[model samples]
Target chain A: MIDVQHLTKRYGRVTAVDDVSFRVEKGEILGFLGPNGAGKTTTMRVLTGYMPPTEGRALVAGHDILEAPLEAKRRTGYLPETPPLYPEMTVRDYLMFVATINGLASAERRRRVETAMERTRVADMASRHCGKLSKGYRQRVGLAQAILHNPDVLILDEPTAGLDPKQIHETRDLIKSLGGDHTVILSTHILPEVAQTCSRVVIINKGRVVAIDTPENLTARLRGAETMFVQVDSAGADATPVIAAVPGVTGVTIAARRDEQASYEVASERGHDIRRQLAAAIVTQGWGLLELRPLRMSLEEIFLQLTTEENAGGAEVPRA
Target chain B: MRNVLAIARRELRSSFASPVAYVAVGLFALVFGYFFYATLVFFAERSLQATQFGMGGPMNVNQMMIRPLMLNVSVIVLFFLPMLTMRAFAEEKRSGTFELLLTRPLTDWQIVTGKFLGAMAMYSLMLLVSLVSILLLFLLGNPEWRQVATSYLGLLLMGGCFVALGLFFSSLTRSQLVAGVLTFSALLLLWVINWTADSAGPVMRAVVQALSITDHFDDFSRGVVDTRHLVYYLSFIGFGLFLTARAIDSERWKG
Candidate 1:
């Protein structure tokens, strides 16, 4: 469990994190979404006790990060933006060193290192030098080092940043498996990763928390226009007029066809999915209906809307 | 303590893995070996029966042992200590491993002391290799083993001081090159401070000589165990370790 209250981090004339506050419940996987330079790494560093907040306080597992740093840090494992790795050491050596630093006993240190290596699928690369490994392997090695001691909290900053698509998926699965056992705060700009891996999402923009909720809830809350994608095999046929004849149809915008079938994006009032009626209308018009599906707003759209609104609101502050 | 040992073992292995450490040892052997043999050949030529090398040239036995074994060892250590200590925190910061270290349960002092001892261990290893010429003195003839032992003790103390200064400079910045240069410059300044103080009169000379690391080495080099000199070397080491701990603490707030 973690609690951050009125947190702020300033660097000289610039403020990196500005009075941001959020809580992560026990066993919850919270995805931190933000654009570049949105203070995601700074906030993660503060939470893991790598750095102290300029203002306010952060508590990890009921211990203050500033006052009881060792206790707070004991419960947290952090993977920085770039995997902090010593090039000269082998994977096993590095993980063992980290395990010892985390205060594991001799036997437990070996067990933890083996367990972490197995979990991150880096067991085979144990004997290889870290610098000689591939980027994906290096990232996994970083993950192994962070989780070697099996801390209660894990703060991973851009965990899958440099990985290829396959490696990213593997990293996502690794992170997802960590949920419910260890509270995780995953900071990344990848939208789909939040949708796929996190139980709740926290969107930060310009050093502020813009929104925090389930991915589904955020999309649902931002839902405004209801549109349906309909593909019909009717080029010359008047499909729009036929669809308008159905119930709840307000307007239809025809989209470019892919093959020879005409596609249309139909807009209707809220709580309206007239697929059956529209099918009957298409049947009556003797036109072939290929596909019909209701479209929902995506996470990307919600993110853009939230961040843009915040930027605009920031500009309006001086005007007011 | 376990963390410190773990770091020490890893750092020691890393030193062997790199060419820099080996090169440092080789360079030390070359310079120190030459100076040691030169002292012995000169002593043999003069047929001096004295047991100790006296201070300064025109070569007393005390000067022979101290200048070659003690002074030259410090000079060799001066060249290599920075190279070892430069990687202490600066390399970690550049590579982002410092963040990983902080997120763990260890305190700032634990990390700093662990790294300090680690670097010191490597330096000691290099110093041990330079002992070869001292051992070779036994083969040439019956040399005063007591004088040899005391000279070694002096070399160890001086080496410790240099390692401490190097570690402090290493913590002051994140650039290894800058750390190396600053360490070299600081040690060089200390070496010349006594000379500068002599020009400024008796009071200044007394202060500067007391502060001079080599000046303290003279006690041990003469087979004399001065408690004040021992304390000075220790205080130098403690001060550097203390500042290193504070530097690490400051980084947390700055970050």
Candidate 2:
């Protein structure tokens, strides 16, 4: 478990991470979402014992990060934005060095090194120098180093920033596999990735956490009314007013148009299955209901709404 | 202690893994050999250096044998110590690995001590290799073994102090070249001040000579281990290390 209370970091007149506080339960994978230049990195650094917070206390695994730094650090693994690699050392050697610093026994160290390499799928390139590897492979090696000690808490900042699509998928799978055993806190601005991989998400904007909850819950909370996206065979017919005229339809907007087809997103009053109603209404109108599905809120929309609402100082009214 | 050793071992390995280690040792050997040979020829011409005035003047055989050797060693170190220490923290910062290191279980002091010791170990190895010349000198001409040992000891201690300073300077910058130049310049200024104090007046020279590294080394060059001089050198090294740790801690706070 990680507990941070009233955490703050100030640089001269500017505050980087300002009076922020959050907690991570054991075996929970918490996604830290924020825009660029936000205090995500600073907050992670403080929790990892890289720096002390100016005005707050952090407890990681029952040990204070400031008062018992070593104990706190011993149980944590960190991967910064850039993979902190010694260019001259090979991937194998780097992991070994990290293992030694993590206080692994010799026999256990060797085993852990191999295991980390295997887990991150960098075993094939174990003998390659880290300096010569591609950015994607370097990220993998960084992940390997972070997991080398089997740390109870893992803090990764922008872990998949420079990876190819295939590598990103594999890295997500790796982080997901670590969820049940290690408390993982990963910070990234890529919202969809968080929706796909994280069990709980924490949205931070301007050095403060604006929202924290399960991804589903956050999306659900942000949605004020039921919404559905319906595609029909229009053949040059306008579907916006027809969709709005459906029973329980509160609002209608033309989302897109293609050859012989038009798609409309319809919002209905609360406690309404607008999908079935819209499909029935389209069918009765002699329009072929091509596709009708509930309008699920994407992580990007939730992120922008929450951050903007926090800045505006108004109660965030989750609107569909 | 284990963590310290782990960092030390990695640092030493990195030193040798790069070309800097070889270049430093190779240049040191080349320069030291040139000086030793030139001094031997000069000694033969001057009838084995019958007399040479030190700071107090009127030196003995051991002083004559050891003073020249230590002076040459010190001069060589003025050029080489920076190479050993310039990359201590500067390279880590430049490569963005300093943050990686700080997040580990090791404390700031441990990291500083580890890097310092790593540089010292490499330097001592070079000195050990250079000592082959001392053995060769003994074989060729019967030099005083006691004076030679004391002079080497003094060189080692002085080298340690310079390493500390270089490490501290390295922590202050991200550019290794800048760190290297600054370290060399700092040592050269000390040497210049030491010599200038000799030709100048009493009061100002007293202060200058007190700060001179050569002054503390004179007794060791003459086979006398003054506890005061040893204490001074040790304290200088300690002060440098302390500042290095504090500098690293301060960066974390500000970063």
How does chain B score by TM in each prediction?
A: 0.90, 0.92
Give candidate 2 regions above 4 Å deviation.
A234-241, A257-261, A309-320, B48-61, B199-201
User: Which pairs of residues clash in candidate 1, taking residues 3 or more apart in a chain or in different chains?
Assistant: B52-B61, B52-B62, B53-B61, B53-B62, B53-B63, B54-B62, B54-B63
Q: How close is candidate 2 to the true structure, as a TM-score?
A: 0.94
Evaluate every candidate with DockQ and list the scores. 0.78, 0.76
Give each model's clash number: 7, 0
The prediction achieving the highest DockQ against the true structure is 1
**A1-320 in candidate 2: lDDT tens per residue?**
99999999988889999889999999999999988878999999999888899998999989999999999999999999899999989899989999988889998988999999999999999999889999999999999999899999999999999999999999999999998999999999988889888989888888888888999988777777777878899778998888888889888878889988988878787677766667777888898888888876687877878777644223233444
**A47-147, model 1: which lDDT tens digit per residue?**
98888899989999889999998899888888988998889989998888888888888878888899999999999999999999998999899998878
> Per-candidate RMSD vs. true structure?
4.2, 3.3
Q: Report iRMS values in order.
A: 1.1, 1.0
Q: Would you list the C-alpha lDDT of every candidate in the order shown?
A: 0.81, 0.87
Model 1 DockQ, alpha carbons vs. true complex: 0.78
